[model samples]
Target: MAPQIVGLAFGHFALRMNPILLLGALTGAQTVTAAMAAIQERSGSPVAVLGYTPAYPIANILLTTWGTIVVAVIAS
Candidate 1:
């Protein structure tokens, strides 16, 4: 929650990104599909998905790779 709040603020104020799209991207990075869905539904626009799509796959790949590294480290 804290990270999400900070990210939203940073994206909105510092980066000057659209709040709705930033929220979508944040949700995507976190792999929170439900939040993304709610955002789209509330905004009545699929535009947020533009932010989500790229972030989602990248985040998934990075997280999976990191998890594998962590497991290898633990096993070693």
Candidate 2:
């Protein structure tokens, strides 16, 4: 819900920019591959993947590290 709200807000703001790329980044940040595929299908372009690539890996690493830290702290 929260990410969707943010995505919608960004989507509105991204109107003047590259909507495809912004959607890509948003989906990537949330790790939603289905959304990325839908966006590609709707836009008939794979340009959004450019934004997804970087955000996905970074988010994955950060979330994993943070989750591990939280678990360790709680366990200890």
Candidate 3:
């Protein structure tokens, strides 16, 4: 999931930099992704690079919400 999100993020980067405002948004989101992955690992449910199933959906939602809010604030 991290890889997928990172891939899509790069694709977004390739497409355009619409409404470019403050810097640090990309790095911030990456940090959020790392936090999510770390939480999953702490729970003993890691989603590795090769293949695995994610076990903590709720925690992921929280991390994602955190990321979204950060992005939104930056975008605004």
Top lDDT hit: 1
The C-alpha lDDT values of all candidates are: 0.92, 0.86, 0.45
Instruction: Give lDDT tens digits, candidate 1, residues 1-76.
Output: 8988999889999999987789889999999999999999999999789889998999999999999999999999
Candidate 3 segments whose C-alpha is farther than 4 A from its true place: 1-55
Q: Any idea how many clashes model 2 has? A: 0
Tell me each candidate's TM-score. Answer: 0.90, 0.79, 0.27
Per-residue lDDT of candidate 2, residues 16-68 (tens digit):
54778888888898888999999999999999899789989998998999999
After TM-score superposition, what is the CA distance of residue 60 in candidate 1 from its true location, in Å? Answer: 0.6
Q: What is the lDDT of residue 2 in candidate 2?
A: 88
Least accurate 10 contiguous residues by lDDT in model 1: 18-27
Give the higher-lDDT candidate: 2 or 3.
2
**Residue pairs in steric clash, candidate 1?**
none
Q: Which of the two, 2 or 3, has more TM-score?
A: 2
Model 1 residue 73 CA deviation (Å) reads 1.6
Q: What shift in Å separates residue 72 of candidate 1 from its native position after superposition? A: 1.4
